[model samples]
Target chain A: MQAIMTLKQVNYQAENKHILHDINWAIPVGAQVTLTGPSGSGKSTLLRIMAAMISKTSGELVFDGQPIESYDPVLYRRQVSYCFQQPTLFGETVADNVTFPYRIRKQPVDHDHILAALEYVGLGEQTLTQPIVDLSGGERQRVALIRNILFLPRILLLDEVTAGLDEQNREIIHRWLRHLNVDRGVTTIMITHDAQEIAAASTLAKVVAGRLEVQA
Target chain B: MNLAVNNTSLFFAAMLVLVALGISLWQKLGLDKDIIVGVVRAIVQLFTVGYLLKYIFRVDNVWLTLAMMGFIIFNAAWNAKKRGAGIANAFPIALLAIFISTGVTLGVLILSGAIRLIPSQIIPISGMIASNSMVAIGLAFRSLNSQFHDQRQGVLERLALGSDLLDASIAIVREAIRTGMAPTIDSAKTVGLVSLPGMMSGLIFAGVDPVHAIKYQIMVTFMLLSATSLGSIIACYLAYRSFYNAQKQLK
Candidate 1:
């Protein structure tokens, strides 16, 4: 099995306080990994570091056998997409959020692709032109999910993506993630505090006091 | 030829008595002592500037003129930098913004022979250009800081979706520059109807021909618009980076 991302002795600190100390993890290609931990256990920080949103104080972060530092940060983020725990939507309309992938790549926004992605997320085709301000939390989360995956990134780092979703929406997102991994072979690193999500994950990594304990 | 400023004491005393009315009103309105302090500082500063200008004009060297222009820009940039204390390296950003605007505008005037690069023309004109640029940069900085703060999630989300730093901040940068330049644009629109600007009023009070003063004032407005637009754009571009880290995440 080939590893897609390898972290060795990762450490992060701010203002004389340690956030992550000596973290070592390997994310294999096409694997779905879930990170579970209590609040303030540095799970989100670890996820952000994985996404290259923030750099580690000291460590080697390698992606696809190349040091993450070797890749252009913008292109790296394009391949390794990071979704926040909160439903972070940009611009006024769902089209605005969904078309973001095309806008970044300097490619024309395909209306059909946007509509299809929205529909896949249980949103109607009419929802594409709808203003994000009018969206409920669950709808916003689904919109964000579709937005991140529209370009089909190699790795997806999701932080509490289903926290605010209803049971139906949660199941919708779960099926999407499963499809993304099984069908599309996209690598995933997710942070979830829910017991059911932890129990259901094929590979579980728990962080406690900035230490990782993997149980598969 | 220097214009005579006669009866300086009487003029100042009358001004003081007039401002006392304002102080009384401010006190009634529960305004703080900062107002009084500001007024006192203004008096001291103007008098000091008056003496310095007298000497500088008497010396009448190009180097002195350049020094005065530098001093004006530095002071203006310092004040502008304070408006966005949260931005890292704000003073340098403001200095660069003010320099670009003031330098390019004055360079055009000098190159076109619209104005002489001398103490009389360069000092006063560059002062206006620099100060206006200062205000524009301050507005740009504040707008950028607040926008990045309020729209943290939006900016970061865009980055995650593969938007480059420039692409992610395009809308915000546009808004910030517009916000910075709006006051100048609006003021120019309402010039004669709303209020007489300070430089025009000063020229008229000094007994210059009204038509001549009006021409100078028109020139001032055009120069200001040019400087402020450039300054705000530059400031926004430079300051936007402070909100993001090395990996393009919202800091």
Candidate 2:
């Protein structure tokens, strides 16, 4: 399989400390790779670097056939989306959060599609106009997830998005991820600590002491 | 009739401070030390400025006038920079904002013949314009800093969705500008009714016609509004970029 992203000797440093040393990894096209590591092992930092949310201290990162820097940051981010561990909902209502992707793209918001996505995530049509301030943690996370997929990206970076979800919601998210990866062919690179999720992943990668180790 | 303001009369004006000090002591306000220090500083500073202005006016040199204006603007910018302590390049940004606003307003005044290009005229007007711009820019910086910090998550989320820097920060920028311009706008609205401003009263005390003093005051008000608006907008546009990194990510 051709690789969608290749990071060669990427390193991240902050405040005179090497957070990620000379490290390298490649993400395959249409692959769901579970990334596991002990706490503070630079998992999220690596994910952010892949998402272009942060600049690498040194080394080369290429996306598709071109250098990441060659692409406009806005357009690059649109094609490669990132989800935060703590979901952030902006503006006033759930509809605001759900339709942001369309807003930024200057496309007409499809309320029907938004309602459908909310329903798929176990949130009803009534949740569309609900105030974001009134949402629970699970609801906010689901909204953020649905927002990320409103317009599909070639790759999705998940930074422990399901860390605090209940079993049912977690299962829903897992099923959603599988559908996205299998049916839609969106490449997924997720940081996770769930044992079952780790056991079930088709491809597993670990970041130990800032180094990548692929498991067969 | 011109009211006498010789040294004797001015010396007697010290009665006002004594009255204030007596009241503070009577009320047990414990403000005696502060009042004494403030009175002494005010006297010294005003006398020094008075003598400097007298000398600059006598010479009537364009360079001397310009140097005086620059001094006022530099001091104003320095004070404003303190309000934006953590913002990158805050001093230069403040200086530029104050300079442009003051320069533009003074240029218009001189060109319109409302004020002459001399120390007596240009220096005082420049002081007023620079000081107002400085306050406006300071308020703008404070607003920008707080808004960016408080709205970090919102800005980051917008960036994640591929919104460009300007698009991500438009709302915050507008809010900061509005915050900076609010005082000027409020004073314009309540100009004559709320209080008699300094320039008009000073002209009146100098035996200028009331109608003429009112005209000068109106001109001052218009110039102030223009100065503050320009300063706030320039400062905000320059400062918003400080919140982001080279990767276009929120710092």
Candidate 3:
């Protein structure tokens, strides 16, 4: 099996504070990897580095055997979708937010596919026309997830996506994620502090103070 | 009509002073003393220019008019810089835009015989063109800065997707251009119905025929629109380059 993403001895410092230091990690293709850590354990920083939101100070990152720098950052990001911890919806309508990536890419947007993705996330058809500001937290998370899926990225980076959701919504998300990984072979790297989610993951890695230690 | 000091002027001046004092006393409201000082300074400056203009009209020396126009441009540039303080090298760019826009507009107007090359025509027309350009440039800078800030993350996202920096910023640049031109557009739309413009009113007061004053007014309006559009477009394009580094990444 080939590794989908590799971080070799990565070191990152932001605002004079060491965020990720001497980090070596690998995610094999089609793996369901969950990163579990305490608050301020550099999980978000590592994810951001993978997404190319911030640059790493030292070492190399390679995605699918190509040096990350060799590929355009925007193209890389498009191929790897990062669902933020706090969902950031751009447009006023759900349909607008979902189709944003397609619009940016200048591709033909399919409203039918968008509606299907929304339905997959348990959102009603009418939700597409509803204003984003009127949506609840759970609805917004679903919208973000649908957006990521619609973009059809090779890798999905989840950052505490269900942190603020109720148990019902949490179960719905977990089930959808499990189905995505097990059935579709979609590569998923999720960060979570939830014990239930940690127990359910195929592989669990703990991060402490910028260092990763795979749990026994 | 009698040339006596009108009660309206005294009342307006008194009201302005009262507002300044009130704002000064209410420091907790975030109104700074510099704002009050600026208002007072403007009052003094405009009054001084008014008295000097009377002597200038009497003497009718072209050099004196040109010299005073230079002073007005310098002051306009300074005010523009103050308004757009955060932009790097904004003062020089703003001054350059103002100079180019005003010079082109005035030159075209004079050459076409729309405005006679005299103090009465040149002074007011040049001042109007220069000040309007200054406002347009200031708005362009402000809109550019705010648009960049608001869309920085989205722009970075686009860059990571193999899009060029120019491609990523195109939407924001378009928005800024639209916002920067809004005032000029509004003025053009409402020129006659909403307000009587200063140049036409001044001409009427100087005993010119109404038809003649209307022609000059129409010419001035079109000139202002052209000057503002050119200044804003040039300034926005120039300022946008400063936001990115050589590595094609946002700074």
Candidate 4:
């Protein structure tokens, strides 16, 4: 079966230092994979490369069998969403931030669908109209996640999404992530340092010193 | 009216020097030598322009007048570019905006016969409009570039959703224009109440009737408002375009 996403012998260098060396990894359609690594082990960098946020020095990246470079980067990014470690929400209101992608695309936003997405992420209806600055850290993360899911990307690349959340919020996010993967059949590739998150994921891949090691 | 440096002039000069000295001493609290150099440069440049204007007014040559206007536009562009580093192509955009805005406003004044097409009228009117537009364009360019940097990811996400570059940056561009023209808007709103305008004051000092001077001041202020608005909008649009690639995608 063709993988939903594939990285073959990918090597990346920055500032004359090798950041990612010979990374060969694949996420089959609908698979939930977690990447765990020590700080500066290139986990986030690997995700960035996969998301096409940065260019690789060598090798190939493929999305759904076609080379990633061939796919329009913007289109690929839309289909393959990348959630940063920190929740970055733009605009004054939560609704504004949520509807940003739709607004940019000139698509009419479905308020019902947006509310449903927020509800799924455990955010209340009130959150849609709240000022962005008023939202707590966990709320902001949920909002960011909601934005990603609202676009309904085929692949999700999350980088330490739950690092700053409390246990309760983390559990809430974990449940939603699992639901998205198992129920909706959305492919998820998450990078986290949390042992519990790694253990809970369907598959865990460890990276150390710029090399990938899959754990059965 | 005789042009003489009186006690008021000396007092004002002394006050300015004292302010400069205070600021220079305050540099100990993080003010650098560059600030002093900038003030010194401003004094030299203004004095030089004062001397040059004296001779230019006597000659009243159209070519010399136009040359000075071009110089103003060029300097405005240079300053805009200097302030808008990391956003290439800002200089030309600002230059075009200032040129078109000032030219249109000044042209209107000339066509209306409100101001004669002489060095005296064209020079001051053009200088005021061009300088105001310069500030507006500079602010617009700075705001647009900074907003682009801040919203890079948000912009990418929008593009991914199939939004065009212009669509993604429209909000930022609007914001830039608003910020750029804010000073002009404030000045127009508070004119005569907050302070006597330079144009009216200068005319009154030269023995022009207060009513006539008020008319000129009104025309100048309105022209500046229009020029600043136009320049800011044009510069912001061009600056927005500069952030994108040939394929109409954000770079």
Error of 1 at A82 (Å): 1.1
Alpha carbon lDDT at A215, candidate 2: 83
Candidates by TM-score, descending order: 1, 2, 4, 3
- Model 4 lDDT per residue over B1-251, tens place: 85677768965776766676677687664454666677679878988998999989988888888898899888877887776777778788888999999999988999989889888778888888888998998888788878998888777655544456677788899999999999988988998999889999988888899999999889988898889999999888777877876444566
Q: Which residue ranges in model 2 land beyond 4 Å of their true spot?
A: A106-116, A122-126, B1-41, B107-119, B208-212
**Tens digit of lDDT per residue, candidate 3, span B1-251?**
33445668776667767676677677666565676777779879888988999889889998999898888777777777776656777887777877888888899999998878889778888889989988888788888788788777766655544456667677777777677678988988998898888888877777788799888789978898888887787766666767776445677
- TM-score for predicted model 1 compared with the true structure: 0.90
Give every collision pair in model 3.
A73-B160, A74-B160, A74-B161, A75-B160, A75-B161, A75-B162
Winner on lDDT between 2 and 4 is 2
Worst 10 residues of 2 chain A by lDDT: A19-28
* TM-score for candidate 4, residues paired by index: 0.84
Question: Each prediction's DockQ?
Answer: 0.66, 0.59, 0.20, 0.24
After the best TM-score superposition of candidate 3, give how far the Cα of residue A180 lies from its true spot, in angstroms: 4.5
For candidate 1, lDDT tens digit of each residue in B48-111? 9989988888889988888999999999999999988889889999999999899999999889
Tens-place lDDT per residue, model 2, A1-216, is 798999899999999988887777777899899999998999998988888888899999999978899988889998899999997788899988888888788899998888878888889988988999999888899999897888888999999999988998788888888888999999998999999999998999999888889885
What's every prediction's RMSD, in angstroms? 2.9, 3.4, 5.2, 4.0
Candidates in order have lDDT scores of 0.87, 0.90, 0.80, 0.83
| lDDT against true structure, model 3 | 0.80
Model 3 bad stretches (over 4 Å): A179-185, B1-81, B85-126, B144-175, B186-195, B237-251
Q: Mind giving the per-residue lDDT tens digits that candidate 4 earns over A4-84?
A: 988899999999999899999877899889899899999988987777667788998888889977876667777888888
Worst 10 residues of 1 chain B by lDDT: B1-10
How well does candidate 3 score on lDDT at residue A118?
73
Better of 1 and 4 by DockQ: 1
